[model samples]
Target: MLGAHDSTRDAGRAQRWAARLAWPLLGIVISLGLWALAARYISDVEVIRAAFAPQAGLKALVHLLGSGELWPHISTSLQRIAIALLLAMAIGVPLGLCLGLSPLFARISGPTFQFLRMVSPLSWMPLAVMALGVGEAPVVFLLSFATVWPIMLNTAAGVAALDPAWMRLAQSLSATRWETIARVVLPGCISHILTGFRLAVGIGWIVLVPAEMLGVSSGMGYFVLDTRDRLAYDELMAGIVVIGGLGFALDWLARTISSRWTQRGKQG
Candidate 1:
């Protein structure tokens, strides 16, 4: 009976894995089919041709792989993104914690935060350029600005969702305010905080490309502009593909890490 049950469970797991893999594979097949059909039927003047031409884009990707120039641009963009993400976490998490823990503070600052958050990050580009000058700083600032809200909001939500029983028990044990927070609040909220970080990284990555275009000479954004200037549509498309792949990879990595951490926390 046990052996048969084990076999059944294994078959179920295998089926699930197959199903998960099939969807993405099917999506890719469908996308490629659509691309081929569009390429065949669409007018040459359409952007779709330049965007999806495999031969041209593949060649451009190969050229980029061979050249040292591509690496530098990728590195610079990644560096700026990393810095901005770190800065956003540093600022957002503490503010979020405070707002979550103290009702008075939340009420005082909520309106101001909402107002700032509602304003589009792009709208600040001109001001960022004027105030910070045309450089990586402005780009990083804009990326960080775009990212901060998600982390902040998530952190606050995490804190708010903490079990009140834990706090009550800690107080009953005569725990000091700091001791209770350190022992109870942080650990309870950590999973949510990590979720926030994953979200923030995604937002930062999305903003980084456009923010890099704000006048930085090096980075994927500049590469895109350069490709356009030279009428290298294939290279432009290739750069865009690279950006998207990298962003997806980054988000996947972060989520994997977060899941592992959550699992560990549960086990402990």
Candidate 2:
């Protein structure tokens, strides 16, 4: 009797999940249909010298995967993003902490940081290339430049939002400056830091393709350019799909981590 009841409960739960997923599945179907239509329309264009329909894209993607041609590009792109984010975090976290902790420093640097943030990271391409030279250095610099602002801003905001009571408790405990920041401030800012990191990842990924185009030989960005120049439009489309998938995965991972950390912090 208990076994039958548990089976029934599982079936009901499965049905509920299917119902919840129905609209999203429908949306995916609609999007695929639209993409197919667009490919068909592009095929009919006389001047478009590429056979890049949905079929071509699927074939190219499959070929790329089967031949292991996509792996290197994917790895390169991931590596650059990882390095750039680490560099951004290293720089942004300290700067952000300073801004949050010192009123005088914040006042002095606020306008400068804002002005710098307002400038497009791509605009630094020439200088980055010139100063850092071509290859991965320039690409990493550009991505880090684009990614750092959000992290710094978010960290600072998190610090600023911290309760005075926490600070008082730290001081009351005779926590040193480093101890106060390490324990009280940084812990409190974990959620904000994660939020900023999430934003930074988005920004970095968006800038990555263009940054990779500078002088790097391998990456998704370079793959796009190669496919374009070779008139391999289907491969280009496949590359686009890969990029989107990777970005979505990264964003999902970041959100998951952030949520878990936030929940843990709250519970603690």
The best candidate in terms of TM-score: 2
| Candidate 1 backbone collisions, by pair | none
TM match of model 1 to true structure: 0.88
**TM-score versus the correct structure, for each prediction:** 0.88, 0.96
Backbone clash total for model 1 is 0
lDDT on C-alpha atoms for all candidate structures: 0.87, 0.92
**What would the per-residue lDDT of candidate 2 be over residues 1-268, giving only the tens digit for each residue?**
9999999999999999999999989988887778777776775664453456666777889999999999999999999999999999999999999999999999999999999999999999999988999888899988998999999999999999999999999999999999999999999988999999999999899999988889889999999999999988889989998999899999999999999998997898
* Candidate 1: tens digits of C-alpha lDDT, residues 135-159: 8789989999998998898889988
Residue 215 displacement in candidate 1 (angstroms) = 0.7
Give the count of colliding residue pairs in each prediction: 0, 0
The alpha-carbon deviation from the true structure for residue 140 of candidate 1, after best TM-score superposition, in angstroms, is 0.8
